[model samples]
Target: MNFDLTEERQMLQDTLRRYLRDKYTTSVRNEIIDSDTGLSDSIWAELAELGVLGALFTEEQGGFGGAGFDIAVVFEELGRAGVVEPVLDSVLMGGRLLAAAGKSDMVEEVIAGALHLAVAHGEPGGRYDLDHVHTQADGDTLTGRKAVVMNAEAADHLIVSARDGDAIGLYLVAQGAPGLTIQGYPLLAGGRAAEVTLDKTPATPLGLTLADYEAVNTLALVAISAEALGAMETATALTKDYLMTRKQFGRPIGTFQALAHRMSDLLIELEQVRSAVINAAGNLEAHDRDLHLSATKNLIGRAGRLVAEEAIQMHGGIAMTQEYELAHIAKRIIMADHRFGDTDYHLERFIALSAA
Candidate 1:
């Protein structure tokens, strides 16, 4: 099996990389992070126009690319830039769920960037379980609290998970609906998420099952694992550059034998992360997708922490400064581990699946 990117994917990667490099400078990203909404509307609109949003869906869902590689390619670029936009929330989670539920109209709007959506599935104590929905749907109304809903403030609609009888169901709740309240706050990395409170809010039931949610959640795992890989790459590169330029006692610190050896170790670990991401992306649609994704995420969680901590240690106090690029990059790398599942969580899941 050849590991090379196909012509189309290579072009996509190059185009996205160039665009982000030109437009998403560290200063500009800091401004976006400091803004009221914790995101840049102009940048989001431009990304939509560039077909970045469309790339996450299939042709049938009004996108040219929706394959696993497509998601990996796009998100990796986003992560490398340390972009704070909620593309993963809006497009991958919300839009893909909508598409799977036959909500073509909503999916088209999302692809066009006209409709911002968020998936409100996680609860206060749910951890990372997709089926641990305590939100109850009484007929067409839902009443429960959704914790840490990303992009909830900017969303036009929310895709909520609720318990309907003995099965878990998805419900669509319009933004500003009666009995809905959202308290927004900034995330540690960048961007904003909200604590959503629903008190018997009217919602439209979506025709989707728990299994569908699981599949999309797995896709999200693939996306963030790839994102972590890009972040690790950037962190490693930044650290390498710092070591080569920052002098210590009239010599470049990179020339120190100990530091050089540590950098070498980081590079080896980064390559391991890359391999895991590749395996996860390749097995996205396979029968054993869950097994592979669990392994990939577990590896990502451990390796990402190592890269972040090592990068910070290698760079010294300067790495923690808010103005410095590595500060945010390291945060992203560490936070990616917490998104889908942590190292311990995925390790147990991988072991369980292996036994099965």
Candidate 2:
């Protein structure tokens, strides 16, 4: 398969980059961080109007006949801009799961941007092993505790993975369901996450088969990995720019041989990670299940941490300051390591799979 960006994708990415750069400049992010609302609702509306919210779904589901690469383009731009939007959680979590489960009716509403949805997957334990879930779905009620649900409070709907009878399944829980309570919180990164507790909360079943569940979850992980790559790339560029302008002993600090070599090594790792992201994204529709996500997430975990640390080191004290973009970038990268699975987690899984 050819690894190339189509004309439409190029158009989509360039437009998003320009729009976000203007509207979500560093000032905007800083303001949002301090505001009563963690994010700008107006910006979210703009994204929906720009068709970005619906661009990853197919036309059959009321979308523009888009693809995963379409999502990759938008996410890359968002990462570069350090955007804090729930669009990723909306599409990657609820929208993809709906599509994977063949819920075309619900999928249409999501693609049309009428409903904001999130996946309440994480539990008391940090592990994302959905199949080993302890949450129970009893009739129309679900009882469980979910932590760090990305944009959970903002979601109109939530797709929760839980243990159903003898099988692991998904439950569609409305945000307004009785006995459901959500408390908003901030992630270590510059984004917001929520904790949701359900005590016999009313819910509908997604009825997705095991294959569909796995595919949707894996695709979400790969999507996050792509975003991580973008964050690292942006952080590295910012670091390099800072080094060139920052002077020591009446000369640009970047001229030092040791720092130059360190930047070079980090850049190489970034390129390798880019290749991994592209390969995994391209194979999102392919037959190989574990190989695609495992490779991408593992590479992202490694690259995200490595590049972020180097970027900080190059920026000196400024990098650690919360006011600096580098601080947010580094936080996002570190969170990515724990997002889908850290390097240690995915690497171990891959090794076990290889042995099997």
Candidate 3:
């Protein structure tokens, strides 16, 4: 099978890579991470202007490219640059959910970067179950707590999941709605998330169901796995460069057979992750997408941890310093496993799906 990117995808990849390389340096990223908001408004706006946000949707949804490959191309670049923007929260999760709910207006705003949105589905102790929703909606009001809501502090509106009778429903709650409270905190991977509290908060019910959330959640899994691949790419590259340059006992440490073997192992692991991501991305619309996605995420979780740890160890103390690129890259790689689901979670899911 042909694995090469099409002309459009290749162009998109090249354009995004060049733009990020020129603008998103390690120093600039560090400042963004240290900032109170944990993101850059100017950079976010620029990315929108460059059509990065639009790439994640389809022409029917007011975007030119919404295919699986499009998401892979965009997020991989973002991860490689260690961008701290809330693209994953604002565009992939919130924007896609809005699109699924037929909320074209809100999706348009999201694509234009005029409105930021966060998905408030994860409740305390829910772990990674998409069907596990404890937040209840009584009429047009919601009362529940959402845990670790990414980009909640910056969101103009939140897409919250709530129990409505026997079904899980999606609700749109405006920021600062009555009885709504958001306690924002910086994430380890250079973005802001919040623990959101709602007490009889007014909300607008969306025309979406549990299935919609599950589909979007699966897409999110594919997106982040691709992001992990990009991060691993950067981390391993950084480690390879360090090994070749940093000398030990009058010779480059990488010249040692032991270190060379270790680096080769990392490269092999990275390629394995790359293959898994590709498989997941290609099968996004397949009937057996869950199996591939679960398998991909499981591999990413294990391989990402391996890549992050090995990269840091090979680089020594300097790799842990915040100023170094690998420090943040390593953090991004490790933290990615926790999103959607971790290694063990996906592994079990894959096994269950396979058995059925």
Candidate 4:
């Protein structure tokens, strides 16, 4: 199948790239990360106005695009820019779940970027099991802990997952509802996550009970894998530029045959990642979507590690410094392995799916 982007997608990509290139400067990003909220309201509003948030949903959900490529196109740009916005947590994951549950009206503020939410589904030992929820739902109250809730600190509402009479269900818990606690901190990458606790917190049922969980998880995997692909591309380009500019023995290190060969290997790895991402995106709605998603994530985790490690080593000490862009990009690529499922996790998952 052809991989060429459609004209609309191409325009969206170009527009997002230009916007980030001009506004998402290193200093500006640093400030945003260092801000009290750990996010920039102004930039968030700008992205909304530019129709970035609207692209992740469909017309039924008040968005223009909700396909795999739409999610991939938007996330890849965010990854390229190393944006710290909560688009993934809010629009892609939480918002989509809300829409699927017939709570599309609730997401209007989110689509407008005036609100943010997080899916508090992961538990301390869930280990990538989407339905392994220990959160107990007793009538209208929830009680349990959710670990690594991305964007939780800034969330206006949390899409919480709990066991509803032996079936996993989602609840909408307001941020400051009684007995709710959020301990937020920055992640190894640029953004923040929170360890959330709920003690009989009042919640509203969203009318979903993990029935469409695979679709949600697969969609997230597809989006994040695309994001990792973008990070790898950036890391590769940055390393290549450094090799050409940094001189060694009165010659550019990239001119050395051995180093050139290594760069060639990196290029090959990048192409492999790109192909895997494309395959996953294309097969997002297929009958064997789980197999394709697991395979894509497996390749991404492994390739991301190689790209991150090689980029750092090639750049040497400077790459380890926090101020450098390569360091952040590398961190994102490596940390991406921990999200959804790691290399080994996905490998096992793919095998199990294949066997079935």
Identify the candidate with maximal lDDT.
1
lDDT of 2 by residue, 160-244 (tens): 8777778877888987899999988876776677889999999888886555666666767766877888888889889889889
Tens digit of lDDT per residue, candidate 1, span 1-356?
89899898898899889999999999999999888788888888889888899999989998999988899999999999999999998889999999999999989888888899989989999898887888899998999999999999989999999998899989999999999999999999999999999999999999888887887898899899999999999999999999999998999999999999999999999999888988988998899988999999999999999999999999999999999999999999999999989999999999999999
**What digit string (tens of lDDT, one per residue) describes model 3 on residues 186-235?**
89999899999999999999978888888888879888988889999999
Q: Which pairs clash in the backbone of model 3?
A: none
Clashing pairs in 2: none
Q: Candidate 2: minimum summed lDDT over ten consecutive residues — where?
A: 208-217
TM-score of 2: 0.93
The number of residue pairs in model 1 that clash at the backbone is 0
**lDDT, residue 88, candidate 2:** 75
- Each prediction's TM-score against the native? 0.98, 0.93, 0.98, 0.98
Relative to the unseen true structure, what is the C-alpha lDDT of residue 293 in candidate 3, on a scale of 0 to 100?
95
Clashes of 4: 0
- lDDT per residue, candidate 4, 49-162, as tens digits? 989999989898999998899889999999988887778887789988888888866768878988888899999988888878999999999999999999898888999999
- Cand. 2 Cα-lDDT: 0.79
